[model samples]
Target: MPPPEPGDVINYIYLFAHEAAAGRDEGVKERPVLVIASDAMGVAVVPITTKGEARSSRSDRIPDPVARAMGLPRAGESHVVVNDVNDFDWRGHDVIDLKTGSFLYGRCPPTYFQKIVRAVQASAALITDRR
Candidate 1:
Protein backbone atom coordinates (compact mmCIF):
# COMPACT_ATOMS: atom_id res chain seq x y z
CA MET A 1 0.00 0.00 0.00
CA PRO A 2 0.94 3.66 -0.26
CA PRO A 3 2.65 5.42 2.63
CA PRO A 4 1.15 7.78 5.20
CA GLU A 5 -1.04 10.74 4.46
CA PRO A 6 -3.19 12.86 6.73
CA GLY A 7 -4.52 10.61 9.54
CA ASP A 8 -1.75 8.10 9.01
CA VAL A 9 1.45 6.94 10.74
CA ILE A 10 5.04 7.83 9.87
CA ASN A 11 8.61 7.55 11.06
CA TYR A 12 9.86 11.01 11.99
CA ILE A 13 12.95 12.63 13.42
CA TYR A 14 11.64 14.66 16.35
CA LEU A 15 14.20 17.37 17.06
CA PHE A 16 14.49 18.46 20.65
CA ALA A 17 14.09 22.11 21.62
CA HIS A 18 17.71 22.33 22.68
CA GLU A 19 18.85 20.53 19.56
CA ALA A 20 17.00 23.03 17.42
CA ALA A 21 18.37 25.94 19.45
CA ALA A 22 21.16 26.60 17.00
CA GLY A 23 19.52 24.99 14.01
CA ARG A 24 17.63 21.79 13.04
CA ASP A 25 20.68 19.62 13.54
CA GLU A 26 20.46 17.23 16.51
CA GLY A 27 17.34 15.20 17.31
CA VAL A 28 16.15 11.91 18.76
CA LYS A 29 16.58 10.29 15.34
CA GLU A 30 13.78 8.05 14.01
CA ARG A 31 10.51 7.78 15.98
CA PRO A 32 6.92 6.98 15.19
CA VAL A 33 4.50 9.87 14.67
CA LEU A 34 0.83 10.16 13.76
CA VAL A 35 -0.16 12.41 10.88
CA ILE A 36 -2.99 14.46 12.33
CA ALA A 37 -3.26 16.93 9.47
CA SER A 38 -1.48 17.97 6.25
CA ASP A 39 -1.59 20.84 3.79
CA ALA A 40 0.44 22.77 1.27
CA MET A 41 2.38 24.20 4.18
CA GLY A 42 3.35 20.99 5.95
CA VAL A 43 2.17 18.22 8.28
CA ALA A 44 0.94 18.46 11.87
CA VAL A 45 2.19 15.44 13.76
CA VAL A 46 2.02 13.75 17.19
CA PRO A 47 5.17 11.90 18.19
CA ILE A 48 5.37 8.49 19.86
CA THR A 49 8.10 8.33 22.43
CA THR A 50 9.67 5.38 24.26
CA LYS A 51 9.82 7.29 27.54
CA GLY A 52 7.09 5.80 29.76
CA GLU A 53 8.37 6.68 33.18
CA ALA A 54 5.69 9.32 33.64
CA ARG A 55 2.25 9.57 32.08
CA SER A 56 0.96 13.00 31.15
CA SER A 57 -2.40 14.32 29.91
CA ARG A 58 -0.94 14.59 26.40
CA SER A 59 0.40 11.09 26.22
CA ASP A 60 -1.18 7.66 25.63
CA ARG A 61 0.14 4.18 25.04
CA ILE A 62 -0.39 3.07 21.48
CA PRO A 63 -1.99 -0.32 20.97
CA ASP A 64 0.39 -2.98 19.72
CA PRO A 65 -1.76 -3.91 16.78
CA VAL A 66 -2.10 -0.29 15.75
CA ALA A 67 1.62 0.22 16.05
CA ARG A 68 2.27 -2.83 13.95
CA ALA A 69 -0.21 -1.62 11.39
CA MET A 70 1.53 1.74 11.38
CA GLY A 71 4.93 0.08 10.91
CA LEU A 72 6.23 1.80 14.00
CA PRO A 73 9.66 0.76 15.20
CA ARG A 74 9.53 -1.15 18.49
CA ALA A 75 5.89 -1.67 17.70
CA GLY A 76 5.31 -3.79 20.77
CA GLU A 77 4.88 -0.71 23.02
CA SER A 78 5.04 3.07 22.81
CA HIS A 79 3.32 6.31 23.86
CA VAL A 80 2.10 9.17 21.66
CA VAL A 81 3.26 12.55 23.01
CA VAL A 82 0.48 14.91 22.02
CA ASN A 83 1.64 17.98 23.89
CA ASP A 84 4.84 17.81 21.88
CA VAL A 85 2.96 18.08 18.63
CA ASN A 86 4.41 20.23 15.88
CA ASP A 87 4.23 20.98 12.17
CA PHE A 88 7.19 20.31 9.88
CA ASP A 89 7.69 21.75 6.47
CA TRP A 90 8.51 19.41 3.63
CA ARG A 91 11.39 21.55 2.44
CA GLY A 92 12.88 22.42 5.84
CA HIS A 93 12.69 18.95 7.39
CA ASP A 94 13.83 15.47 6.46
CA VAL A 95 10.48 13.71 6.05
CA ILE A 96 9.50 10.46 4.44
CA ASP A 97 7.87 11.55 1.27
CA LEU A 98 6.10 8.51 -0.14
CA LYS A 99 5.63 10.11 -3.49
CA THR A 100 9.34 10.71 -3.96
CA GLY A 101 10.54 7.63 -2.09
CA SER A 102 12.34 9.84 0.39
CA PHE A 103 11.72 7.38 3.25
CA LEU A 104 10.40 3.83 3.07
CA TYR A 105 8.13 3.37 6.12
CA GLY A 106 4.41 2.50 5.94
CA ARG A 107 1.20 4.15 7.04
CA CYS A 108 -1.48 3.27 9.63
CA PRO A 109 -5.15 2.76 8.96
CA PRO A 110 -7.78 5.50 9.33
CA THR A 111 -9.37 3.67 12.26
CA TYR A 112 -6.13 3.85 14.18
CA PHE A 113 -5.66 7.47 13.19
CA GLN A 114 -9.14 8.26 14.50
CA LYS A 115 -8.25 6.67 17.82
CA ILE A 116 -5.12 8.80 18.03
CA VAL A 117 -7.06 11.95 17.17
CA ARG A 118 -9.56 11.18 19.90
CA ALA A 119 -6.78 10.69 22.39
CA VAL A 120 -5.21 14.01 21.42
CA GLN A 121 -8.56 15.76 21.71
CA ALA A 122 -9.11 14.25 25.12
CA SER A 123 -5.68 15.44 26.18
CA ALA A 124 -6.35 18.93 24.89
CA ALA A 125 -9.60 19.03 26.81
CA LEU A 126 -7.95 17.79 29.97
CA ILE A 127 -6.19 21.12 30.37
CA THR A 128 -9.29 23.23 29.85
CA ASP A 129 -11.28 24.58 32.80
CA ARG A 130 -15.03 25.09 32.68
CA ARG A 131 -14.98 27.10 35.89
Candidate 2:
Protein backbone atom coordinates (compact mmCIF):
# COMPACT_ATOMS: atom_id res chain seq x y z
CA MET A 1 0.00 0.00 0.00
CA PRO A 2 1.04 3.58 -0.54
CA PRO A 3 2.11 5.86 2.30
CA PRO A 4 -0.68 7.67 4.11
CA GLU A 5 -1.20 11.38 3.51
CA PRO A 6 -0.90 14.13 6.06
CA GLY A 7 -3.64 14.02 8.72
CA ASP A 8 -4.09 10.29 8.13
CA VAL A 9 -4.13 7.97 11.11
CA ILE A 10 -2.23 4.81 10.33
CA ASN A 11 -1.03 1.68 12.08
CA TYR A 12 2.74 1.35 12.05
CA ILE A 13 5.51 -0.40 13.92
CA TYR A 14 7.24 2.22 16.01
CA LEU A 15 10.24 1.15 18.02
CA PHE A 16 11.12 4.61 19.31
CA ALA A 17 13.50 3.38 21.99
CA HIS A 18 15.44 1.37 19.42
CA GLU A 19 15.42 4.25 16.98
CA ALA A 20 17.02 6.44 19.65
CA ALA A 21 19.71 3.89 20.56
CA ALA A 22 20.60 2.10 17.33
CA GLY A 23 19.58 4.73 14.77
CA ARG A 24 16.87 2.32 13.65
CA ASP A 25 13.38 1.33 14.77
CA GLU A 26 12.02 -2.19 14.84
CA GLY A 27 8.67 -2.97 16.42
CA VAL A 28 7.04 -6.25 17.29
CA LYS A 29 3.47 -4.95 17.15
CA GLU A 30 1.48 -2.34 15.32
CA ARG A 31 1.15 1.17 16.75
CA PRO A 32 -0.85 4.26 15.81
CA VAL A 33 0.81 7.21 14.09
CA LEU A 34 -0.46 10.41 12.50
CA VAL A 35 1.10 11.00 9.12
CA ILE A 36 2.53 14.51 8.76
CA ALA A 37 3.95 13.98 5.32
CA SER A 38 4.37 11.28 2.70
CA ASP A 39 6.89 11.11 -0.10
CA ALA A 40 8.51 8.59 -2.35
CA MET A 41 11.21 8.01 0.24
CA GLY A 42 8.76 7.34 3.05
CA VAL A 43 6.45 9.01 5.51
CA ALA A 44 6.96 11.61 8.19
CA VAL A 45 4.82 10.77 11.21
CA VAL A 46 4.24 11.48 14.84
CA PRO A 47 3.36 8.73 17.29
CA ILE A 48 -0.10 8.73 18.84
CA THR A 49 -0.59 7.13 22.24
CA THR A 50 -3.76 6.04 23.98
CA LYS A 51 -2.42 7.06 27.39
CA GLY A 52 -4.52 10.13 28.13
CA GLU A 53 -2.58 11.22 31.22
CA ALA A 54 0.53 11.41 29.13
CA ARG A 55 -0.71 14.65 27.60
CA SER A 56 1.62 17.64 27.73
CA SER A 57 2.07 20.92 25.88
CA ARG A 58 3.70 18.95 23.10
CA SER A 59 0.73 16.73 22.48
CA ASP A 60 -2.88 17.20 21.46
CA ARG A 61 -5.78 14.95 22.41
CA ILE A 62 -7.66 13.33 19.57
CA PRO A 63 -11.39 13.80 19.88
CA ASP A 64 -13.20 10.53 20.62
CA PRO A 65 -15.52 10.80 17.63
CA VAL A 66 -12.61 11.39 15.28
CA ALA A 67 -10.71 8.46 16.76
CA ARG A 68 -13.58 6.11 16.17
CA ALA A 69 -14.13 7.48 12.67
CA MET A 70 -10.51 6.73 11.93
CA GLY A 71 -11.19 3.10 12.93
CA LEU A 72 -8.86 3.16 15.91
CA PRO A 73 -9.55 0.39 18.40
CA ARG A 74 -12.04 1.14 21.13
CA ALA A 75 -9.20 1.96 23.43
CA GLY A 76 -9.05 4.86 25.83
CA GLU A 77 -8.50 8.42 24.66
CA SER A 78 -5.69 9.05 22.21
CA HIS A 79 -3.25 11.89 21.59
CA VAL A 80 -0.71 12.78 18.98
CA VAL A 81 2.85 13.26 20.29
CA VAL A 82 3.52 16.18 18.03
CA ASN A 83 6.99 16.96 19.32
CA ASP A 84 8.37 13.52 18.47
CA VAL A 85 7.74 13.52 14.75
CA ASN A 86 10.15 11.47 12.61
CA ASP A 87 10.64 10.21 9.09
CA PHE A 88 10.31 6.53 8.34
CA ASP A 89 11.55 4.83 5.21
CA TRP A 90 8.90 3.02 3.21
CA ARG A 91 11.13 0.04 2.54
CA GLY A 92 8.41 -2.37 3.66
CA HIS A 93 6.26 -0.19 5.88
CA ASP A 94 2.96 1.42 4.97
CA VAL A 95 -0.62 1.51 6.24
CA ILE A 96 -2.49 -1.33 7.96
CA ASP A 97 -6.07 -2.58 8.22
CA LEU A 98 -8.07 -0.85 10.94
CA LYS A 99 -10.65 -3.59 11.47
CA THR A 100 -8.74 -6.88 11.42
CA GLY A 101 -5.46 -5.16 12.21
CA SER A 102 -4.23 -6.26 8.84
CA PHE A 103 -1.85 -4.40 6.50
CA LEU A 104 -3.80 -1.52 4.92
CA TYR A 105 -4.36 2.22 5.34
CA GLY A 106 -6.89 4.22 7.31
CA ARG A 107 -7.87 7.89 7.45
CA CYS A 108 -9.76 10.33 9.66
CA PRO A 109 -12.15 13.18 8.88
CA PRO A 110 -10.57 16.39 7.55
CA THR A 111 -12.26 18.50 10.19
CA TYR A 112 -10.52 16.71 13.04
CA PHE A 113 -7.33 16.33 11.07
CA GLN A 114 -7.16 20.11 10.86
CA LYS A 115 -7.01 20.21 14.62
CA ILE A 116 -3.82 18.21 14.59
CA VAL A 117 -2.36 20.41 11.89
CA ARG A 118 -3.03 23.49 13.95
CA ALA A 119 -1.38 21.93 16.97
CA VAL A 120 1.70 21.05 14.98
CA GLN A 121 1.78 24.49 13.45
CA ALA A 122 1.67 26.08 16.87
CA SER A 123 4.47 23.84 18.06
CA ALA A 124 6.53 24.72 15.04
CA ALA A 125 5.96 28.41 15.59
CA LEU A 126 7.27 28.08 19.12
CA ILE A 127 10.36 26.29 17.87
CA THR A 128 11.00 28.99 15.30
CA ASP A 129 10.75 31.68 17.94
CA ARG A 130 13.11 29.77 20.21
CA ARG A 131 15.70 29.54 17.46
Candidate 3:
Protein backbone atom coordinates (compact mmCIF):
# COMPACT_ATOMS: atom_id res chain seq x y z
CA MET A 1 0.00 0.00 0.00
CA PRO A 2 1.12 3.55 -0.64
CA PRO A 3 1.22 6.47 1.75
CA PRO A 4 -1.51 9.04 2.26
CA GLU A 5 -1.19 12.58 1.10
CA PRO A 6 -1.17 15.31 3.73
CA GLY A 7 -4.53 16.65 2.66
CA ASP A 8 -6.06 13.20 3.02
CA VAL A 9 -4.80 13.08 6.56
CA ILE A 10 -6.27 16.48 7.30
CA ASN A 11 -9.59 15.61 5.68
CA TYR A 12 -9.94 12.32 7.53
CA ILE A 13 -9.08 13.88 10.83
CA TYR A 14 -11.69 16.50 10.09
CA LEU A 15 -14.19 13.77 9.28
CA PHE A 16 -13.53 11.99 12.58
CA ALA A 17 -13.82 15.24 14.46
CA HIS A 18 -17.18 15.97 12.89
CA GLU A 19 -18.45 12.52 13.76
CA ALA A 20 -17.28 12.84 17.35
CA ALA A 21 -18.69 16.36 17.74
CA ALA A 22 -22.16 15.34 16.59
CA GLY A 23 -22.02 12.39 18.92
CA ARG A 24 -21.38 14.75 21.85
CA ASP A 25 -23.81 17.53 20.95
CA GLU A 26 -20.81 19.84 20.97
CA GLY A 27 -22.10 22.10 18.15
CA VAL A 28 -18.82 21.62 16.34
CA LYS A 29 -19.94 20.37 12.99
CA GLU A 30 -17.26 22.20 11.02
CA ARG A 31 -13.87 22.60 12.63
CA PRO A 32 -10.94 20.84 14.18
CA VAL A 33 -11.84 19.39 17.55
CA LEU A 34 -10.25 20.35 20.81
CA VAL A 35 -10.69 16.99 22.46
CA ILE A 36 -10.62 17.30 26.20
CA ALA A 37 -10.07 14.29 28.43
CA SER A 38 -12.72 15.51 30.89
CA ASP A 39 -15.37 15.45 28.20
CA ALA A 40 -16.25 12.24 26.38
CA MET A 41 -13.06 10.47 25.50
CA GLY A 42 -12.77 10.25 21.72
CA VAL A 43 -9.72 9.42 19.67
CA ALA A 44 -9.01 11.22 16.42
CA VAL A 45 -7.37 9.15 13.68
CA VAL A 46 -4.49 11.14 12.30
CA PRO A 47 -1.34 10.38 10.28
CA ILE A 48 2.23 11.24 11.11
CA THR A 49 5.56 10.58 9.44
CA THR A 50 8.67 10.29 11.57
CA LYS A 51 10.77 12.51 9.41
CA GLY A 52 10.60 15.94 7.76
CA GLU A 53 11.20 15.01 4.15
CA ALA A 54 7.75 14.42 2.64
CA ARG A 55 6.25 17.81 3.31
CA SER A 56 8.01 19.25 0.28
CA SER A 57 5.25 17.86 -1.90
CA ARG A 58 2.41 18.56 0.50
CA SER A 59 0.28 21.56 -0.31
CA ASP A 60 -1.72 21.85 2.84
CA ARG A 61 -1.80 24.62 5.41
CA ILE A 62 0.19 27.75 4.77
CA PRO A 63 3.32 28.78 6.54
CA ASP A 64 2.99 29.24 10.31
CA PRO A 65 4.90 32.45 10.37
CA VAL A 66 2.26 33.86 8.09
CA ALA A 67 -0.50 32.32 10.16
CA ARG A 68 0.86 33.78 13.37
CA ALA A 69 1.42 37.14 11.75
CA MET A 70 -2.20 37.05 10.63
CA GLY A 71 -3.31 36.52 14.25
CA LEU A 72 -4.34 32.92 14.26
CA PRO A 73 -4.59 32.04 17.94
CA ARG A 74 -5.53 28.42 18.33
CA ALA A 75 -8.87 27.59 19.97
CA GLY A 76 -8.91 28.63 23.64
CA GLU A 77 -5.25 29.56 23.57
CA SER A 78 -4.26 26.10 22.29
CA HIS A 79 -1.46 25.53 19.82
CA VAL A 80 -0.08 23.08 17.25
CA VAL A 81 3.45 22.57 16.03
CA VAL A 82 3.61 22.09 12.27
CA ASN A 83 6.89 21.03 10.75
CA ASP A 84 8.34 22.73 7.73
CA VAL A 85 6.98 21.16 4.57
CA ASN A 86 10.42 21.46 3.11
CA ASP A 87 11.77 19.43 5.96
CA PHE A 88 9.14 16.71 6.06
CA ASP A 89 8.25 16.36 2.38
CA TRP A 90 8.63 12.61 1.87
CA ARG A 91 9.45 10.70 5.02
CA GLY A 92 8.67 7.39 6.68
CA HIS A 93 5.53 5.33 7.16
CA ASP A 94 2.97 7.23 9.18
CA VAL A 95 2.89 6.31 12.83
CA ILE A 96 -0.09 6.53 15.19
CA ASP A 97 0.69 8.74 18.15
CA LEU A 98 -0.59 8.69 21.72
CA LYS A 99 -2.94 11.37 23.01
CA THR A 100 -2.36 11.78 26.73
CA GLY A 101 1.23 12.94 27.06
CA SER A 102 4.10 14.87 25.57
CA PHE A 103 5.40 13.70 22.16
CA LEU A 104 8.30 14.90 20.14
CA TYR A 105 8.37 13.74 16.52
CA GLY A 106 11.27 15.00 14.50
CA ARG A 107 11.67 18.11 16.63
CA CYS A 108 7.94 18.75 16.51
CA PRO A 109 5.76 18.13 19.57
CA PRO A 110 2.44 16.77 18.20
CA THR A 111 1.59 14.54 21.23
CA TYR A 112 -1.22 12.48 19.67
CA PHE A 113 0.05 10.49 16.68
CA GLN A 114 0.02 7.09 18.34
CA LYS A 115 -3.37 7.56 19.96
CA ILE A 116 -4.83 8.48 16.61
CA VAL A 117 -3.27 5.37 15.17
CA ARG A 118 -4.78 3.19 17.87
CA ALA A 119 -8.17 4.78 17.39
CA VAL A 120 -8.03 4.31 13.65
CA GLN A 121 -6.75 0.78 14.07
CA ALA A 122 -9.72 0.00 16.29
CA SER A 123 -12.05 1.45 13.71
CA ALA A 124 -10.43 -0.73 11.08
CA ALA A 125 -11.54 -3.78 13.08
CA LEU A 126 -15.05 -3.59 11.71
CA ILE A 127 -13.65 -4.02 8.23
CA THR A 128 -11.47 -6.84 9.41
CA ASP A 129 -14.38 -8.60 11.08
CA ARG A 130 -16.34 -8.49 7.85
CA ARG A 131 -13.63 -10.51 6.18
- Which structure among the candidates has the greatest lDDT? 2
Give the RMSD in angstroms, all C-alphas superposed, for model 3: 16.2
- Report the lDDT tens digits of candidate 1 across residue range 7-89: 66666676543344446554557666677776665677777777752334356776888777766667766777655555666
How many residue pairs in model 2 have overlapping backbones? 4
lDDT of each: 0.60, 0.62, 0.25
Could you say which candidate leads in TM-score? 2
Find the 10 residues in a row with the least total lDDT in model 1.
122-131
Alpha-carbon deviation at 7 in model 2, angstroms: 2.6
RMSD of 2: 5.5
List all candidate RMSDs to the true structure: 6.7, 5.5, 16.2
What's the number of clashes in each of the models? 0, 4, 18
Question: Per-residue lDDT for 58 in model 2?
Answer: 66
Order candidates by TM-score, high to low: 2, 1, 3
Evaluated against the true structure, the overall lDDT of model 3 is 0.25
Residue-level error in angstroms, candidate 1, position 112: 2.4
Question: Candidate 2's residue-wise lDDT over 34-105, tens digit each?
Answer: 777777767767667776423233676777877777766653577776655556666454344567665434
